[model samples]
Structures are given as C-alpha cells and as structure tokens.
Target: MVAYDGTDFSGFQVQPDQVTIQGEIEAALHRLTGETIQISGSGRTDAGVHARGQVFHFDTKSGIPLDKWRFVLNNQLPDSIVIRSVEEVSSEFHARFDVKVKEYRYCIDNGAVPDVFRHRYADHIRSPLDVEAMRQAARHLVGRHDFTSFCSAKTVVEDKVRTVYDVRVESEGQVIWVICRGNGFLYNMVRIIVGTLVEVGQGKRHPDELRTILLGRNRELAGKTAPAKGLTMWEVSYEE
Candidate 1:
C-alpha cells in the first residue's frame, strides 16, 4: 500500500519524458535491486489527484528482503510519494483485477476564504451547499446503473455500467465531504457525481432530477467535472 500527494507529475502512468508516480518508483526499485521492475497499480489516478491507500504489485526475483522494502523505498522516493506497506502475496493476486470494492473521498472547503495550506488538497468553494438537498440527490446514485451521464466525454470505455454501493454527503463547518463506495468506477465518474451534487446543493437543479440524469445517460445533462485536486482514493478492498 501507498499514500501520495499527486499534485505533481502526470498522473500515475509512465509517459515518455513525463515524471510520474510509477516512473519514479520503478527508477527507485532499479537503483536498489539493479533490475528494472514493472509494477502494476490498482488504478491510475489523474493529475493532481491523491491516494491514501492505493495499491500496486510487482514480481521480483531480487534477494531484497520484503521487510526492508518500505524503508528502502521511502528513503529513495520523493516526499510526495510514500510506500505505506510492503508484503508478499501470491502471484495470482492482481492489483486492479482482484479489487472487490473501492472507496473515494472528495473534500470541499466551503469557507469564505480558501486556506493556503489546503490549496493543494481540497477544493475551495465560496458558496454554501445545501447538505440535505445534496444528500437527497445522491440517493438516486446508490445502486447498479449505467453512469454514462456522469462519465467524461473523452472516456473511451464502451461499457458504462457500474455498481455504486454508497454515496454520502456531509459537512463540518467549512469543510464538506463526499464519500463514494463502489465496485468500480469509470473515468472521471466520481468527479462528475460531485459536480452534479454540488449543482443540486446550490439550487441549480432539483434533487429529484438525479433520476432523470441517470436515465438520460447523456454527458451533456451533467454538471462540470470537479477539479482533480479535490479527489482522493481513500481505500480499496479485496475478498478473502
């Protein structure tokens, strides 16, 4: 497991000439093991996004002890990325394919003035959000459905179906939280859902209109995609 601040780099994937989370980790592994290791990540987070418990796996034949991996990697990795834990698992266990559920959290600072410390972490929205209305609007999203309306227009995935187990919106003074748990999500699905819920909280859309949006299955009917910095992959689960 790993936790990272994704403010820098071009997301988690490796691109030629682009600094990425994967590229850095692979480089560090090479420096330690004298072998180029290809790691498979649980999911690819977008640019400026964050992850608290993101997962990745790689097959290594090096003599390095498993217990020393976390310490060695952290010493070599940048401050933005930290390997939280390192353990050996069966080769059949895949990071992305074996995921049983994933949880994401989107944070919003609804204060009159944005906090300088949270600038890289949370989205600062000056407007007050109607929490009750947003909660009602999110209820329609808690189930298996086609989420095409909430997906990005640039998404190339043909099957837009996904099962969302839970959606909760809550606020603590100036901080608003949106938590989503699901079997899986499409590209930019969580951000679009947050944007739509924010629109409902701002009274720009009726709470009941969420049903229509889901049935419509058209991207144009949805709200703007919330900024990537506000999002975090909170946790991921696998079945025993």
Candidate 2:
C-alpha cells in the first residue's frame, strides 16, 4: 500500500519530462535492484489529488524480503510519498484489474475564512451549505448509472456505466466531507458529483435535478468539476 500527497505530481502515470508517482517509484526500484520496473496503479489520479491508500503492483526478481520492501522503498522515496506496507501476492494478482471497490473522500472547509494549514488538502467554500440538501442530492447518485454527465468531456472511456454503492455527507466543526464508495468510477466522476452536490447545497440546484442530469447524459448539464486538491483516494479493496 502507498499514501502520497499528489500536489507535486503530474498524475499517477509515467510521463516524459513530468514528475509522477509511478515515475518516482520506478526510479527508486531501478536504484535498488539495478533493473527497470513498471507499476500498475489501481487508478491514475489527476494532478493535485491525494491518496492515502493507493495500490500498485510490480514484478521483480530481487530476493528482498516482503516485510523489508516498505522500509527500503521509503528510504529512497521523497517525503511526499510513503510505502505503508508490502506483501507478496499471487502471481495472478493484478492491482488494477482485481479491484472490487474504491473509496474517495472530498473535503470542504466551510469556515468564514479558509484554514491556512488545510489550504492544500481541502477546498475552502465560504458560503454556508445546507447539509441536508447536499445529502438529498447525493442520494440520487447512489446506484448504477451512465455517468457521462459527471465525467469530463476529455474522458476517452466509451462505457460510462458504474455502480456507486454509497455516498455520505458528514461534518466536523468547519470541515464537511463527502465520502463516496463505488465498484468503479469514470474519470472526473467523483469531483463532478461533489460539484453538483455543492450547487444543491447552495440552493442553485434542486436535489431531484441530479436524476434529470444523469438521464440527460450530457457533461454540460452537470455542475463544475470541484477543485482537485479537495479530493483523496481514501481506500481500495479487493476480493480475498
């Protein structure tokens, strides 16, 4: 398992002339084993997003003990990224394909003034939100649907159907969190959902309108994509 502050990354993928999570790990692997390695991540998070439970798998011939891999990698990695754990898995296991569920969290600082400490981790929204309205809007998204309206227009995936198992809106003091758990998600889907919910909270859109937007299947029908800094990949799960 890995956790990273993605603010400095171009994205999770390896890109020429760009710093990325995969690139950094592959470089570390090369330094440690003298062999180039490529990793497959559970998802390719966009720039500025964070991950507390991102997962990746790579093939290696080195004799490094599984328990010691985490320490070895962390020693070589930048402070922004950490290897939380390492374990041997079946040769047949695939990180991206074996995923059974993914959880994402979007944080909002609803204080009258943005918290300086959380500027990079949370979205600061000064307007008082109607939590109940946001909850109602979120409920409409908790099911199987074609999320074309919520995903980015730049998305290349032709199939947009995915199951959102749950959506919860919770608050603590000045922070409001929108938690989403699903079997899968389209690119930019979670952020757009949060944006639409925020609109509902702000009384600019009705809670019931989410259904209509989903049915419309037009990206323009949904609200703006929420800023990436507020989002985090909280967890990923797989079948035992």
Candidate 3:
C-alpha cells in the first residue's frame, strides 16, 4: 500500500503516453524484480484524485524477501508517493476483495478566499456555511441504503446499494471536513455527498431533503458534484 498526493501526476492508473503513479510503480517493480508483473489496485482514481491509503498488489518472481519490499520500492519511487509498509500474507489475501471498509474525507475552505498553498487540497467556498445543518444532513446518509442519487450518472455498476457506516461533518477554524466511511462507494459518491451537504450548510436545502433525494433515487434531484481536488481516500481496513 501507498499514500500519495496525485496533484503532480496524471492519475493512479497507468496510461500509454501520460505519466501516472501506477506506471511509475510498475516500472520500479519491473526494474527490481526482472519480471513483467501486472499490478492490481483496489480501484482506479481519476486524474488529481489524491489518496492517503491506496492499496495495490503485484506478483513478483524474485525472492527479494518481504521485509525489504518497502525499502526497495520506495528507493525508486518519486516523493509524491510513499510506500507505507509491506507484509507477506496468504495468497488469498486480496487487496480489493478481502477489504472490510474504506473511508474518505473532503476538505472545504469556508472563507473569503482560498490559500494559495492549500488550494490544491481544499475546496474554497465563499458563502458562510451552517455547520450544524451540514451535520444533520449527513446523518441521513449513515446506514445501509441505495445511494444512486449520490453517485455519478456515468457509473456503470449494476448495484447501487451500499452500507455507509458513518458520515460526519466538522469545522475547525476555516476548514470544514466531511468524512465518510463505507463498505463500498460508487464513482464520485463522496464528492456528490459533500456537494449536497454543502447545499444544506448554505441553507439552500433542508436536512430532511437528503431523505427525499435518497427515496427519489434520481441523480437529477441531487446536488451538483463537488470538485475532486478536495477529496482524499483517507483509509482502508482489513480483518486481521
């Protein structure tokens, strides 16, 4: 697994001409292991979608050993991506299949202007937001439910029902954080949820409106999708 700020790269997946985090990682792995390994990630993130605990796996023919995997890989990887740790597990321990939960966080700069440095990591909203309203709206999103309204219309997944264990909103000075943990998420699900919650915070929508939208199951009835730069894959869990 690794964590990275994808602002400087094209995306997580490997592309033919464009430079990507996955491409760099595969290149490094090939160079070190002398095998053409196929890397499999938990999911493909769009360009500029940052991750704090992205998981990936690849089969290696070389017997370089497990303890040195992190040191060997990190030595060749760019500073933008950091390999946190590595451990040998059963062959059945899949990165995507054996996962328990995933968490994401979206940051908002609720202020007059955005900071130049923090602009890439947080969305800047000029209007004053009602934090309490946002929190109340988020409560409706918790628990197992069909979240078709919160996902992107282009999502091709057949199943839309997902278990959202928690959704929380909090403000610390100028920063507003929207955090969500779920068993699985559809494409752009977190961004849309944040957008709707932001509408509730701005008093443009009522807290109860979230329930209506969920029941409607219409993407058109939901709020606009928020920007990707503010969103981060915060964590992933697995059963020990």
Candidate 4:
C-alpha cells in the first residue's frame, strides 16, 4: 500500500520525464533491487490529487525479504510518498482489475475565513453553500447510469455508463465533505458531480434539475470540473 501527498507529482502514471507517483516509486524500487520493474496502480489519480490507501502490484524476481523492501524503498523515496506496507501476493493478483469498489472523498472549505492548513487538501470557496441542497442534488446521481455528462471532455471513453452506489454530503465546522462510493468511475466523474452539486448549493440551479441534466447525457449540461487538489482516493475494496 502507498499514501502520497501528490502535490508535486504530475500524476499517478509514469509519463516521459515528468515527475509522478508511479515514476518515483519505480525509481525507488529500481534503486533498491537493481532491477527495473513496472508497477501497476489501482487507479490513475490526476495531478494534485491525494491518496490515503492506494494499492499497486508488480512481479519481482528479487529474493529480498518483504520486511526490508519498505525500509530500503522508503529511504530512497521522497517524503511526499510513503510506502505503508509491502506484501507478497499470488501471481494472479492484479491491483486494478481486482478492485470491487472505490470510495473517493472531496473536501470543501466553505467558510469565509481561509484555512492555511487545508489549502492543499480542500477546495476553498468564500461564498456560503447550502449543504442540504447539495445533499438533495446528490440523490439523483446514485445508481447505475450513463455518466457521460460527468466525465471530462479530454477523456475518450466510449462507454460512459457507471455505477454510483452512494453519494453523501456532510459538514463539520467549516469543512464540507462529499463522499462517493462506486463500482467504477470515469475520468473526472466525481469532480464533475461535486461541481454540479455546488451549483445547486449556490442557488444557481434547483436540486431537481440534476435529473434532467443527467438525462441530457451531455458534458455541457454539467457544471465545471472541480479542482484536483481537493480530491482524495479515500479507499479501495477488493474481493478476497
């Protein structure tokens, strides 16, 4: 397992010459084992997104003890990335394909006062938001349906259908948390959903309009995509 701040990395994928979570982890692994191996992650988190329980898997031939792997690899990795644990799994195990569910959380700072501590983790909006309205709007998104409207225009996915099992909004003090659990999600899907809900919270649209917008099946019908900094890969479940 791995947890990363993801602020400085380009994204989770290993791109050509760009700093990324995968790139850094692979580099660390190569340095530790002297063998270059490719690692596959559970999800491809966008740049500036954080993850608390991201999982990855790779086939390795090294005989190094599993307990020593974390120690040696983490010493080579930067402070932003942390290897939470290392385990030897069967060859059939695949991190991405074996995932049964994914839960994502997006945090919002709703108060007028700026929180310096949370600037990197939560999206700050000075304007007050109606939490109840946002909650009501989220009800329309739960269940299996086409999510083309919530996906990014940059994405080329032909099959836009996805299952959203639950979407709940809650508030504590000045921070509002939007938690979503789904079987799978398209690129930028959760961020877009949160943006659409924010529009309802701002009184720009009625909560009931979300149903019509969803049926529209057009990206233009959805609100703007929320910034990546506020989103986090909260958890992932796999069938044992």
Q: Tens-digit lDDT track for model 1 on 115-185?
A: 88889989999988899999999999999999999999889999999999999998876889999999999
The total number of steric clashes, by the backbone 3 Å criterion, in model 2 comes to 0
lDDT (tens digit, per residue) of candidate 3 on 1-240: 799888888888889899898998999999998888877777777787888898988777789988999999999999888999887767787888877899899999997877778788899999889999999899899999999998998989999999999998988888999999999899989999999999999899999999999999889988989988888888888852
lDDT of each: 0.94, 0.94, 0.89, 0.93
Ten residues in a row with the worst lDDT in model 3? 38-47
Model 1 TM-score, 2 decimals: 0.98
Q: Which lDDT tens digits does candidate 2 get at residues 77-184?
A: 999999998978899999999999999999999999999999989999999999999999999999999999999999999899999999999998999999999999
lDDT of 2 at 54: 97
- Rank candidates, lDDT, best first: 2, 1, 4, 3
Off by over 4 Å in 2: none
**Which residue pairs show backbone clashes in model 4?**
none
Weakest ten-residue segment in model 2 by summed lDDT: 231-240
Better of 2 and 3 by lDDT: 2
Q: Candidate 3: which stretches are off by over 4 Å?
A: none
lDDT of 4: 0.93
